[model samples]
Target: MSEEGLEYLFKVMVVGHSNAGKTSIIQRYTKDNFSADYKTTIGVDFFMKKIIWNEDADILLQLWDLGGQDRFTNLSRAYYQQAVGAIVVFDCTSEASLLHSKEWKADIDAKVTWNGKKIPTVLFANKIDLGAGSFMKDREIIEECCRECGFIGWFETSAKDNKGIDGGMMFLISKIMELGGHAAQGEAAPTNDSTITIRPRPKKVEADNKPCC
Candidate 1:
């Protein structure tokens, strides 16, 4: 999608732990293709898509795929600039990846904002094709994490099969549009009461916290 003329333009970021399939979803969504083998995203990568809002309106979404390795964490704040929406991904099979989702969300809140407002964020539990053992076990904790981090919702996704990507993405887009995109920057951003509220995570998860090596 060329950035020529569009009714609305939004900058969105995709963030998650390394190998959690963040790039896989980007490739699947933007190019309609997926690769079994992929390189880790360095620094940042950008992609854009045009959404036909209606007959008269067109929305161009600018996507920044931020590298998720801990080494790249310091660079994330800069990459997150001007992002009005976020898609936080984690591997369904990896407990570490799932736990790190909160950290990723916290980093975003600590850094960027559009018009001094918390941007809409959603979580993606990627790689469900392999299995969802971790996801299933931590379902309650994940729901609590979503609320604590202010995520609007979370979805189980498999980029390889292209499942749940579009639906989850559009939900985020609608939220951005509801927030009035760049147009209604003057209005105060409203709280999302439907989502989970920020609170102390479950004790089990708290017990599992360990410094990364």
Candidate 2:
């Protein structure tokens, strides 16, 4: 509530099922590197990034990475309160991960009181560098997911190649500024029409086509 709405601050949670590339997306955006052997985030880790809207004002965003393991599900609900935005990411290579996105959204929704208010949520189908044929036909699946779930923004990104990371962050920042409680009362929330073109990375073919079941 800095400067009585002169500037805005937002808490955004990056959440999804296990191994959905949530941590990798955060690391790629904040650090600009991909760790092949990265460890799963145990509890929660916080990362900060500043985004400027105009010449004089800037928005400070706190991005929270929540652990997605089954044991941590009960503990993750505490982090959802008063959250302004959420990036519900899913690995495009795993069709099941996208299905799990709906479940996670429901869990978060159950914790809140609904008065026809909408949270600025973005749905990202990550790991697109793996190619289209690798994952079950994804376009129809993801489009239906967004349409049914009322997600505000949608993007396809590859954390491995660091593509679409900046655009995704910018889209979220724009949304937070538009919806930050005050704007919601008098004005329309930001339009969820962001379009990011992802350039597929050159990936090596793997022999084992095993699903991460």
Top-lDDT structure, candidate number: 1
lDDT of 1 by residue, 1-213 (tens): 233323566789999989999889999998999998989988888998878875545677888988877434566666776677899999988888878998888888877765556789999999889988645675888899898889999999999999999999999988887766435433344344222111111112233568889
Model 2: lDDT equals 0.69
Model 1, TM vs. native: 0.80
Estimate every model's Cα lDDT from 0 to 1: 0.78, 0.69
Candidate 1 error regions (>4 Å)? 1-6, 70-74, 181-213
Which window of 10 residues has the lowest lDDT sum in candidate 2? 194-203
At residue 75, candidate 2 shows an lDDT of: 66
Task: Tally clashing residue pairs in candidate 1.
Answer: 2
The positional error of residue 54 in candidate 2, measured at the CA in angstroms, is 1.2
Instruction: Report lDDT (Cα) of residue 125, candidate 2.
Output: 84
Which regions of candidate 2 deviate over 4 angstroms? 1-6, 70-72, 112-116, 133-138, 181-213
Which pairs of residues collide in candidate 1?
147-196, 148-198
